[model samples]
Target: MTKRLQLADIGSALIVLFCLVPFYWMIVSALRHPADQFATTPFPLPVSFQNLAAAFAERNGFGRALLNSLIVAGTTTLLTLAIGITTAYVIARVEFRFKNVVLAIIVATSMFPGVTLLIPLLKLFVGLDWINTYQALVLPSLSFGLPLTVFNLTAFFKQLPSELEDAAQVDGCSQWQAFRAVILPLAMPGVFTSGIITFIAAWNEFIIALSLTNDQKMRTAPVITALFTGQYKFDQPFGTQMAAGVAVTVPLVIGALLFQRRIVDGLTAGALK
Candidate 1:
């Protein structure tokens, strides 16, 4: 057993290192100059700040794109948490017909390819005259982020003690009052976990944002990155692209670092109980 356990630990460490190699490569590539990318022996180092500087100042307007991304992601995170928390509570605590079926449906939605819905969604946005607007961006984000949030939160909520609600009610609290005062507070870990997931999902989203927004002013970071790879330029501005990649990843890293404890707690809260 000890030998087997040692082998398993080694395997896990190898897997983690394999997963991290691409990220490390990206950091090295982002620092190297475009010319150096093709050099006989390219080492990982920033060729020049010029690449990042130029990428930031390029016509794609990553600054505005980043700001728009922040708005869209921030809004989606808040909305998903508010709606998902309630839906999760209902699903976890309420005994009703077709409950398992409903849960299955929610999980199934996450399995569908989001790309398949793009054209249809774009047409819907056009009918609503919402193309190129923030509404188009926000609605699509909510739809994609909600199902996962609800599923995760429902699992977490199932682990909570029913005695808390009963005690709150015994104190003359109504259902809403009990939920607001008791359930909501205790569900913070789940809430923050969901919010972090939603935020990261929105931040890294590429396809929907690319399809929905045309104006550079409305573009997101990923879409703007696409601008670098065009017909005329066989080679993208490698350094700039790397820097932009770094920029995009920073917020997600910070968010995860800040709420990592909640993430672990939320994901594990009900799994064993």
Candidate 2:
């Protein structure tokens, strides 16, 4: 048993190292001077401050783009979670005709490639005159991400004891009151997990934001960062691009760290009971 445990530990360590190797390389390359990036021995420590400065300097309006990404992602996460939690409670705890069919349709729809529907979606948004605006960026993300959020929250809500709702009802609470006061508080971990996932999805969403918005000032960080490369000479400098990548990744890292405890609890809630 001890030998087996040792092997498991070794395997886990190898997996962790493998996962970190790409991040290590990105940090290393990002820190290197562009001239030395492809050098024979390319190992170098990250020049943290210098790279951050360069990234901000060369990427015109990158700061604004970063702000746009944050606003869009934050709005999507909050709205998605709010709608998903309420709807999931109904789906999981309440009996209604065609519930399974509704869920099946949602799951099936999610499997469709997003790119295939872009033309029609763009036209719809264009008809609504939402182009080149924050609404264009956030509304589409919410539409895409909401289904998964509802699915995850439904599963989690089903695992919760119905006794809590009963107790609240016994204490003269309405269904909405019980839900808002009792169930929602208890299900916070699941809600936070869903929000984190939604935020990451919106943050990384490039195609929709890129397609719908043409104004440079209205661009998200991912879209603006992509214009770095040029045919003969790069429009944005290499070090700056690396720095921008790092910048884009930092908020996601922070969000994951903040909600990590909730994520674990949300995943393990069923197992515990």
Candidate 3:
């Protein structure tokens, strides 16, 4: 006999459907023919590529924005992981003075709203003439992103058996070499989780990008998408706007889908071993 669906199952299905409605609508609106773009049909019929083409058009600058976002997010993710993993490992493994106090302080800073840093950072960058530079974006993101990475990976590292590192050291490996070869590889799940989260956080950011960059070429994908709405050059810009949204969202969506299993593994790390 087939298992019957329970109320909880039905509720979950409803919630998932509700969440997907906007993405579905976005895809449909993006693919709709210009003449019938306003139609509310569930799926786009007689679809057209004009809107997609428009999104990547040189005039739109959304394509360039995508590249800028990729660079910023990629650099931020790598930096956060490199610094965060070592910091987290030290906190987790090595005993030091004010250890809890330092960890607490580090994590507490992440709680402060990023908006609070906006004016201060903008002013500092202007003084240094760093506006519109990749470092301006990546550095601030690191300031916020690094703490969470440290907090998460610290907990993950703590749960891992220290005896594993002991075994590696017993084999003539230096302390650094043991961590490099043994602990870090096993900690992939936590690292992967932190990397993806940091990347998405950096990628979706718009306010900082908008405020920091006056040049259209220096802006991010979301900022460029917002530009599409403000331009009077296109009347009834829904199709083009949705197309921009798709272009901006699809890559992140693909990344999440590809690494979903790893994400699950990260969340459940140390459960079995």
Candidate 4:
């Protein structure tokens, strides 16, 4: 048993290390002096803040891009969760005509390649004169996020005991109140997990943001990072790009660390009961 546990631990460690390698390299490169940005050293020597400074330089419009990402992604996450939770709860707990068909359609929507929606969405949003607006970014993201959110949250809601809802209703709570009060709180882990996925997907989304928003002020971080250029036209600005990468990733890391406890507790709280 001890041997098996050790092997499992080692496997987990290796997987984590593999995932963190690029992140470590990005940080090291971001901290490196522009002159030594290409050095093969494992550690950054003569560290400089130039890359970090360049990342937020006026020409890059990256700071604004960061705000754009926050607005768009945050809006997308909230809207996705609100609609998804309700939709998932109904699908999971209620009996309705063609319920299976509805579930199938939701899954099928997610499976559709997002790229396929590009031209049609662009034309639709253009007709609405919504180009370069938050809605332009958000609505398309919802189309993709809702299906994943609904499917996952539906499964999570199913696993939760229906007796809880029944008990809530018996106590005179309306169906909506029962769901909002009892079930939602208990499903925090699944909600958080799905929200994180939605946020990251919307945040990292590039092609759609690029294709939809023509203005730099409306562009997302990933798009702005791609637009990063050096002091000279010929320069690659690799260090600055690394710095931007670190800047973009740090918030997500911090957020995960902060919420990881809640997620773990939610998962274990059920088993304990």
Model 2 Cα lDDT, one tens digit per residue, 1-273: 999999999999999899877776766767776666655454764444565575676436788899999999999988898788888888999898999999878767777676886899899989999899898888878866788778877888888899999999999999999999998888887787778878898999999898999898899999988766532553546666767888898777776788788888876664455
> In lDDT terms, how accurate is model 1?
0.82
Q: How big is the positional error of residue 143 in model 1, measured in Å on the Cα after superposition? A: 2.6
C-alpha root-mean-square deviation, each candidate? 2.2, 2.5, 2.2, 2.4
Number of the top lDDT candidate: 4
lDDT of 4 by residue, 86-136 (tens): 999999999999999999999898886878999999999999999999999
**Regions of candidate 1 where Cα sits further than 4 Å from its true position:** 40-42, 45-47, 229-235
TM-score of each: 0.91, 0.89, 0.93, 0.91
Worst 10 residues of 1 by lDDT: 38-47
| Pairs that collide, model 1 | 31-46
In candidate 3, what residue range of length 10 has the lowest lDDT sum?
Answer: 1-10
TM-score of candidate 2 versus the correct structure, residues matched by position: 0.89
Candidate 1: clashing residue pairs, number: 1
Mark the 10 consecutive residues where model 2 has the least summed lDDT: 228-237
Q: Show how many residue pairs clash in every candidate, following the order shown.
A: 1, 0, 0, 0
Model 1 root mean square deviation, Cα atoms: 2.2
What's the lDDT for residue 9 in model 4? 100
